[model samples]
Target: ARLFRSWKPQLALHAETSGKNAIVVTAAADLDGAVRDIVKSAFGHAGQKCSAASLAIVEASVYDDERFLERLADAVRSVRVGDSTDLDTTMGPLIAPASGNLLRAFTTLDDGESWLVEPNQIGDCLWTPGVKLGVQPNSWFHFAECFGPVLGLMRADDLEQAITLQNATLFGLTAGLQSLDPVEIARWTDRVEAGNLYVNRPITGAIVRRQPFGGWKRSVMGPAAKAGGPNYVLTMGRWTDSFPNCATSSTSEVDENAQFKEYATAWAEHFAVEHDPSGLAAESNVFRYVPLYRPVIVLVGEGANRDDVERCRLAAKVAGVTMIVSRDDEADLLERLLTIRPSKVRVLGTTSDAIYARCDELGIPVDDTPVTSVGRLELLHWTREQAVSETRHRYGNVRVRR
Candidate 1:
C-alpha cells in the first residue's frame, strides 16, 4: 500500500512461453541456406524459448523436393543434444521432465500427423529433436505451444496457404519467411501479423532494441512495452515537463481536437520509426506499429469534458484502432474488463490509480500515457510494436538470389 502511494516505478516483464514459429517459402530461393536456418531456429535452445520456431510451413514444391528434405533431416540428426556445459553440445535438455502440451507432442501424434524424424529420448530431461510432417490445419500441433524440441512441418500449395497456416495460431510473437524472391518476400511480410518478422535468417535470438519483442493477439499479456525498446519504462514513471524543450510543441489548447490536430502530423511517425539501429550493411531492421486485435477500453470520469472524449476517439482513429469509451461517475473498469476483455485499459481523470496495479497483477496491460498529452507516446498505447529484421547480405556480400 505504501509503494502504491509512493512515486516509484512498477516495472514488469512477462516470461511465459507462447507458440511461435516460421514459414519457409522455398520458391526460387537458397535451399541449403533455408535448411541451415530452419534447423537452427526451430531446434535451437531445444525449442524451449517462446520465440523458437516450433512450426515450419514449407511451400509444397520445396517440401516435396528430396534435396530440401534430405538436408533438413541431416541437419536435425547432426545436432548433439547433451550437457549444456559441453563444448560440443549444440543444444540443452528440456527445462524439466516434459509434460502437458510438450509431452504429448513428444509421445503422440494427431490423426493426420506423422513423424518425419522420430524423437529418441537420450536422457531424463533430453530428447532428440523430432519433426512431424503432414500436420493438418487446425490440428493439435498446429496451435499448441508445445515448448519442446519438436518441429511441426506443414505443406502449403502456395505462399497464401503457407501464410494461412502460419497465422492459424492465437500467438504471433515471432514469425519468419524464407524466400529468395523479393516479390514474394514483400507480399508475405506485408500480410504476416507478428511482433518480429525475419527474412532469410534464423527466427530466434533477437537483438535488443533492434528487434524489440512483444506480440499481438494472445501472445502478450501486459501493456507489452517491449523489453529493451524506448517505451519499456514509460508506464512506471509519470510524465513531467520539468526541463521543457522549446523545440517540442506543448499541448495547451482548450479545444482538445484543435490541440490534437496541431500535433497530428507527428502522431504516427513519432511513436514508431523504422531504422537500422545496428547500421549493419548485411541486415535491415524495421520497427513499426501493428494494431492490436482487440479494442482498448478507455474509462473517463463523469466530469470529463466532451472535448477530452473526442480527443480519445480521434487518437484511436489516427492509430488505426477501435476503442470503447466508458464515462461514468464511478467507472466499473473491473466489470467491463470481465465482459469485454480488452487488449488494454486506461483511465483519464479521477479514476483511481489503484486499478492500474490490480490490472497489472491480472496480466492486463495498462496504458499510463497521460491522456491530455499529445504526439509521441500516445500511439504506443493503441498499437502493438513490431520489429522486422531481415538478413540482406549473405556472408558479408550482397545477396544475389533475391
Candidate 2:
C-alpha cells in the first residue's frame, strides 16, 4: 500500500491499452534516416511495446523503390538478438513464451504478402526481427496486434491514403510519419487517430510532458485521462464544487508549461463549447459537457467547518452543480439520497458511525474529502464525451435538398 501510495497522481485505470501502431514513410523522407528510425521504432524492445510500430504504410513512390525496400529489410536483419544480460545484445527474449499471435506472425505469410526478411525463431520466446512486403489493406495481419518482432509494410497511393490505412484498426494508440514536406506533416497530424504521434522520429519512448501519453477509440478506457498529464489526477477524487470557485481566464499558478496551461484553459471552456472532430460532411461528433446524476445530496455533518461549508455552497453555485444540502442526521439525509437512487452520500467536515451505518443499510458507497475546488478538477465531473453520428444520406439519396 505504501508503494502504491508513493506513486501519486497515477492514472487509476488503463483499459484496452493495445495498438496497431503504424508509420507512414513519404517519398520526400530522408532515406537512411527513415530506415534507421523505422527499424528502431518497430523492432525496439522486440516489438513488445504498446506503441511499437507494427505496420508501415509507405507511399507507392517509395514503397516500390528497390533501394528503400532493400535498406529497410537489411536494417531489420542487422539488429542483434540474444541474452538481454549480454552487452552486445540489442534485442532480447520475450517476457513469456511465444503466444499464438507471435507464432502466426512469424510463420504465416498471408495472401498478397511475402516475407522480405523472414524472422528466424531462436526458440519459443526469441526471434530475429521480420519484415513483410505486399501487406494488403485490411489483411488479417494489418489490424492485428502481434506484440512481437515483426513488421508489415503496406503501400498507399498518397499521404491521405496512408493516414486512412493507419487509422483502419481497432486501436488508436500511436502513429508515426516520416516526411520532409511540412504540408504533408500538417495534414497527417490533423487526421491521424492515435493519441501519441511522431514525425521523423520513433513512435515509442514518449517523454513525460513532452508527449502526454493516452490513446483514442478503444485504445483507452475508464476516465480516459492521459498519464503524466495535467488532468492525471482528475478522476482520483470526486469532483466537487464544495471548496472554492475561483477559476480565471488568465493563468496564475495553473501551469509552468505553456502547452499545459492552454490545455487546462481550453478544457474549462469546453462547458460552453461544442467542437466537431468527425470532419465528415454528414456525421458530427460534438464534444460537450453535461451534468452528472442530479439531486446529489450534500450531508453536512455537525462538526463541519463553517468556512468550508460556505466554500462548498459557493463552489456548487458557481459551477452550477446542484445538490441538496441538508443538516439532517445521517439516517435522514441518507434516506433522501437513497430515495432518489443517486450516487453515495457526500459528507463534509466529520462523518460519524451513524452515517456509515446508514450507508451500510442503504448499500451505497461513501467518501470524505475536504471541501475544495479547482475549475480544471471540478469541471471534469460535469463533462463526458458524447459523439452524435448521422448519415447525411438517406436511402439512395442525400438528406438535404440540392
Candidate 3:
C-alpha cells in the first residue's frame, strides 16, 4: 500500500495490493476483470509502469458491437494523464523521448486506413491513448511490438488464418485469443507460440503475481532476463588449489588433428573408388570394357536378327560405345555409317582386303572380324588384312603389313 501511495500521484488512486507485487489499474473489462485486478496489485509499486493494451482481435460477429467499442473508448478517455507530480493523473511521461518517437512512427503507418489519437489530446504529459483500430490487414502495420499506447488491427479471412497470423510473428512474448467456441479456443491456445497465452481475454491483463511475466525474441536479453521473475546473479567458487596437467586429463584430451587426418584419408579413398573403372570392375566382378574415342560399327545380317542387335546394344551400353549396323545395300549402309561416323567397323564374313578397298574409297577406318563363327578362321584373317589396309589409307603416313 505504501508503494501504491508513493506512485498514486502519477497513476490516479486505482493502485491496489493483491499478492506479493504492486499493480496499477488502468482499464478493466468483464472477461479479464479478475486478472486485471490481480495485475494491478502486482506491479503497482513501479511509479512509471504504464501497462499499455497493445492489440485486440474482435471476432467478426462482433463487428457491429458499437456499445463494446464505445465502452472501451470511454475507458480510454477517462484515463488521468499528467506528470508524476499530479495526484489525479493516471498516466505519466514515457521514460524517454525516443520511446515517444518510436510510438509516433508506428502509429503514422496507418495513414488514413486506421485511427490514431493524438498524444497531446489525451494529456499535457506523454500519455497517448491506449488503442488504435484498422478495418483491413496492413502487413506493414500488423507485425510489431509497440511498448507504449499503440495498437494495430487486422481482419482475417477466417478464424484459422487469424490464429496462423497471430503465431507467425517471431515475437512470442504474449498473446490473447477471444472466441466463444471451446474447441476453437482450445486449438488456438494449444498452437499459439506465445510464452503467456490467454483465451477470451485481453493480453495486457496478465496477473503479475500468480503468473510469471516474460517476453520472447528481441524483447528480452541476457540470462534469466524474463519480466516479473527473480533477477539472477552469477557467482564463482574455487574447488581445487593444486595445479595439475589439465591437458593430460582423460576427459579433457582431444585429437582434433588426428580426426581430421583420418577423415581426409577416408575421403580420398572414396574418391578413388568412385573415379576408377578398375575399382568398379573389381567390385562388380565383370569384365572391364575399354571404350574407343570413336564410334564402332558392327555388320549384322538383318534387322530381324534381334539376338545380334541385343548383343551389340548390351556391349555398347556397357562400354559407353555406339554400334552401327550394315544392311545389304552397301551404299545405303555407307550413308548411314557416314551419319554415325564410327571409328571402327567389324565386318562379318567379308574378307579384310575387300573391306579395306571399300573403306579406302569412303575414307573410313575398319576393324575387321572382331567376333566371328567358329569355322570362319579364313574369313577372319581376310577381314584382318582389310582392316590393316583401311587403317593405312585413313592415315597415309602409317604402314600396314599384308
Best candidate, lDDT = 1
| Model 3 CA lDDT for position 186 | 48
Residue 96 error, candidate 2, Å: 2.0
Ordered list by lDDT, greatest first = 1, 2, 3
Scored by lDDT, model 1 comes in at 0.74
317-369 per-residue lDDT for model 3 (tens digits): 43345665665466666566657655556554443344444543443444432
With a 3 Å backbone cut-off (N, CA, C), the pairs that clash in candidate 1 are: 223-365
**Residue 123 lDDT, candidate 2, scale 0-100:** 73
Task: Rank candidates, TM-score, best first.
Answer: 1, 2, 3
Worst 10 residues of 2 by lDDT: 1-10
Worst 10 residues of 3 by lDDT: 383-392
Q: RMSD in angstroms, all models?
A: 4.9, 13.4, 34.8
Backbone clashes counted, model 1 = 1
Candidates' C-alpha lDDT: 0.74, 0.68, 0.38
Residue 176 displacement (Å), model 2: 0.4
Candidate 2 global CA lDDT score:
0.68
Per-residue lDDT, model 1, residue 264, is: 64
Per-residue lDDT tens digits of candidate 2, residues 55-91? 9999999998998999888888889999999999999
